[model samples]
Target chain A: MENNNNIPIDDLTEEFVVNIGPQHPSTHGVLRLQATLDGETIKDLLPVLGYIHRGIEKMTESLGYKQSIYLTSRMDYLSAHINNQACSLAIEKGMQIEVPERAKAIRIIMAELQRLTSHELWWGSCAMDLGAVTPFFLAFRDRERILDIFEGNTGNRLTMNYITPGGVMFDVLPNFASSIKELLVKVKEHLKEYEELITGNVIFQHRLKGVGILPRELAISMGCTGPVARASGISCDVRKYHPYDGYDKLDFKEIVIDGCDSWARYKVRMEEMKQSIHIIEQLIHNIPEGEFRAKVKGVIKLPVGEYYQRVETARGELGVYIVSDGGNKPYRMKFRAASFSNLGALKPITVGAKIGDLMASMATIDLVIPDIDR
Target chain B: MKSLFQYLKEVFLGFYSLWTGLKLTLYYFTHPRKEIITEQYPENRTTTINIPERFAGEVILPHDENNKHKCTACTLCEMACPNGSIKIISVQEESEDGKKKRVLDKWIYNLGMCTFCGQCIDACPQDAIIMKNSFELSVYNRNDLVKTLNKPGSKLKEKE
Candidate 1:
């Protein structure tokens, strides 16, 4: 027989490699993390991506400006409305279209509601990732109310192509304000329940409090945005700095935490959910009664040039860039995915932490995998 | 003595936090009417399935009584569709004045590829089509997915 030579028992190294998932549930989508471990601590971690890349950007090149906006919703399905807003803003910018006041108010309301839904999903899944299953059910129970509200107005729950070039697809329903007020009350009450149930738990705190610390400089250098960066004391909320759609006029505070750890990320999202409610409360009662959508030409052809628009999605900043050849379809389209940039910081923050803390780190970053892959 | 005091305080604080979490769960367990949950899907369909009226499921070309439809076969829905799921096959016919006029024939819809973006309905100037809220659209045959939206022997309704 030929020599069956492998690494001899005497020469075995302490460092070993472990694959978390290209198809694991904690990942929330198809994301594979190859972690090199020395005993229990991760020596080095590398994220393997592109498992669910549906060629969304390339597909946008062939589709018209109107059709291409819907593809972004599929990219970050949790931030579907926000993704749609960014794409619409880019098109609206290119064509010099002025979105009506009523449309702007509706857009803001929908965007903030989607943000709450996204954060609720994150909160539930974050606790679930750390081994508690109850929060998942609790989170979805609250989320269904918001999705019901979305379905009533947008006609679809997840990938609502409701936000379009000049304005939204349709006007808000008659009971929109009353339903939102009712929802705000319910969600506010549930937030207190969530605080009691998971936020104060000793085990959860010990697992999260100082684990996977991401400092301010590292956060900025990594191009992190949204709650992930804010948790690290980096005030990079695009809403505050570069306010779009009616956010500038609204009275609200950006929830920035200086904890620089997983717990801070958790707290930041919780507070942000409250801020989202505050934003919604400001706009709901006073939605300008006027035309829902402006008169956009049947076919949208962006003038020959490059165009860009950025919006703060649930995870972070989503930038939509389009290059037009004076045609209905874009010559090239690029999505600056916040998850991809935020994913870069995962390895740096988690390399020296225990392998078990990796889940805590991943969950707090709040990555929606299709957002990263797209 | 001081070190012992610190250790005791840590244990007490830990237990207190854990109790708070458990307490919330206990409250929910005791009070049951407020808890929201879902029913079994197929079973609920016969009992209390309440799908929203605005839910987009499948496209249908609405036909009026007297076997008349509103489609002029403009093919705008075909152009509006991101996927080429809709095809308009029109035919020309001679009127009573013997003048040749183009008219609607077949509206072929591939439900398999439809994203239900509702762009097709929005593009129809005639308001000839609307999305029905019936979402139970599963069939054993693949060919059943491709629908001939316009009924056979239906004529286009002239504007009153």
Candidate 2:
């Protein structure tokens, strides 16, 4: 290292760069972080994305309305059901098809269950990121029950292309209500176990308490939503702001915390899981008896117009924008994914934090990288 | 005395927090049988696992005793597939009514590229193709995945 400045060769601490993933386990997917480090402190952080980009939006242009909905499931695999719902809702809005009450209730139930699973996975991974591995096992145990319920009802577990434009692809199974009730009871007990495992631990608290302090204004300006924004006191829950499906009918609280730290983000997701359970309980008993699918033509062609619909995924707001030119295929399709926007707030909060702190912050951000890349 | 008191307080607090965290894991470890969540793959294949009825594993055409399918060769599934997973091959033949009618020659579904979106099953107006529950689709060669849905010497089910 050469120092040109006359007065300060010894005083200047040379800053070096470190690359934290494109393949690191903590990244949760293929996200490369180019961090400028002065010792252990991150001076600057830049996230390099698109390692997993499959051109989902571009592919949607050629696909018909029904075919395009399936592509959204691949974008945010963690919240695939919600992603599919957003796309369907947008098409339904354009086509002006009223989804049946039963279908709406089922959609909300599925979305809430999907939310719980996503958060459960997040909780596990977040704990694992901070060096506690047991929570991963504990969280997955409960998450498997949710996946079982999803598989039993929707046929597939992860990429459930079950939600369609008119309604769900299939009706709920006969044991849907009982299975959910059983799951809700188990989950309630497990949430306490989770709290005991990590939330109240001094080590976990010390790592997360004041690390990555994101202010509400910064979160808002960065276009953060879901738990990340809500943690910062932004109150940006799309379910609360603009209710869709049967969310308007069911009652639930939007968990917001003013801590603006990693702890707050973690707590928000934890509380949101409880709220998801609450929403599911309210609707499971009363999934109105009616047609699961609304009447729609074989080939769905939306009139020439622009349509936009947004739904709250476990991560954040998933907005589906479709531009149709009086054709079966959309002329243009765009997805405003939550992870992509939340990834922007990472550098702002993580800068000046330690390398260990960066992992804590990133974990709390709860990024599903395909959602970012897509 | 003050310094001693501070050190003891910190020690007690730290141990208490650690104890709280370890308690749950200890309970899980002790009750291993009850807490075990993993499904033993391959070993427990026969008794434990029951694949759900609607599981979208592979697309198949159900044939009747007469070796006939319900496919009209409408190319609706081909159009519906997001990927070019479904390929419909048809031949124009003069029917008994002396009119040119397109008949199905081959309905090819490539399992390798199939996302199991159920769009093809939904779009099939004739209820010809459906997703089967057999999910063990792994094969030695990729060519094995390119399944021809229609049975050999199968004809379209005649209109009732």
Candidate 3:
């Protein structure tokens, strides 16, 4: 036993450290946050990452323009289509290829479907993180429908290397649009149930409200995008603002709120899901009959330049920065992950917040660690 | 004085919202048609993948009646695989006109490292490769998984 000095040991002064993850289920994937706590109040928060770093950027430099699409799937395993789209767009930019209009529509549909699927999973996981168990299955109930749609065309659920350089690897299946329309009805019905199960719950609101308060100015300064930023009333959705892949043709709105809390983030995601359904409904009917891909040259030699492609995932903005060296492969691929940038905001937000609020706060932050690591 | 009533009203409204959620989820549970969505994998053996005609899959050398393949043993597929999943050994044969033609000696397709990306299928110039709708590619023995389609001393006869 050591004798303490004249320092008073209050709850604030009584120090304790907790390692939140590396293997924790709520982390979504291998992300360790070392937090210094004083009686359930997080004092200092530090994110420890790089557990799932696959050196994808280095691996991409060796692969050809067409070969690098598979590597994108591993970046954000949950939203592989968005990752594939970003990479394909960069390659298309480098090689100066314009995919046909029909391909653009298909790409938009696939991306929106991916957005819906990713948000569906997020709804479930965020509910589970907040100690609500039943919504996980409810969200997956909708998610499996989306996965079957993906598996029908792309051949897998999670990692779809379907998007190619000039266009997609393959054309949309014959009944793809009709089948998706069928799933769309179910998704809308299920979303209504989700709103009931999680969104309106007092416990969920109590867990989320005024928790992880990221103010608008700080969010802007940190370059946060997607739902996290949109929660703070920042309307920076790439689909609406940048308008890639027939996004301009469709009618949709970016869901934004000024509440600047976890509940605001939750509301934005829920509303975004509704908007995604609306977009799918509008786009699926007008799918045109045309070629899905163009004839790309045998050997792709990218001109010496840099190309940047950004897409809004369920979590946040995913930036793919590619530099071409007039060769078959990319010279450098730097991913400016939304998770990485959003995780930086945690230390400022989590300070003085209760330990229970940390999970709610982290869930709102919505980090995909492999995206950060890559 | 009015602010106190407003705060109380909000508190009551929050409870109302919570009640709304509970009612909706309970309704779903009672309506069991919305609950289960699993398709039994083995039981539904007649599942339709609806594979397109142009889909690139496994690299088959197009075997004919004489047990001959269309592949000229160019070993292009071996170079295309990112994971070194394909290995092909070829031997040179002299034609009657004294021109040398490469004949396949050993063809190795390792399912262990194959990513099924269809790159090797595209690299073959001789429309010799096609991805068959064979999804049941699982095997207990690792050695049994690495299939060699071309046997030794078999000449690759051209298609009619």
Docking class of 2: high
Model 2, B1-160: lDDT tens digits are 9999998997888899899888877877788788666889888888998788888889999999999999999998898888899999999999788999999999898999998888888888889888899988899998999999898899999989
lDDT of 3 by residue, B1-160 (tens): 8999998987898888878877876777689785577666676667833433443345455576777777777787787677788888888889899998888887888887877777777567786666664567788898987878685556776656
Q: Model 2 clash pairs?
A: none
**Top candidate by lDDT:** 1
Give the better candidate number (1 or 2) by TM-score: 1
Which wins on TM-score, candidate 1 or candidate 3?
Answer: 1
DockQ-sorted candidate list, best first? 2, 1, 3
Report how far off residue B20 is in candidate 2 (Å): 2.1
lDDT of 1 by residue, A205-234 (tens): 999999989999999999999899999998
Candidate 3: clashing pairs of residues: B57-B131, B58-B131
- The Cα error of candidate 2 at residue B62, in Å, is 1.3
Top TM-score model: 1
In candidate 2, position A181 carries an lDDT of 91
How well is each residue in B1-160 modelled by candidate 1, as lDDT tens digits?
A: 9999998998998899989988877777888767566657888888888777788889998888888999998898999999999999999899999999888888999999999998988778899999888888988999999999999999999999
Candidate 3 RMSD computed on C-alpha atoms after optimal superposition onto the true structure: 3.4
How high is each candidate's TM-score? 0.97, 0.96, 0.90
User: Over 4 Å off in model 1, which ranges?
Assistant: A1-13
Error of 2 at A341 (Å): 1.4
Which ranges in model 2 have alpha carbons more than 4 Å from their true place? A1-12, B1-7
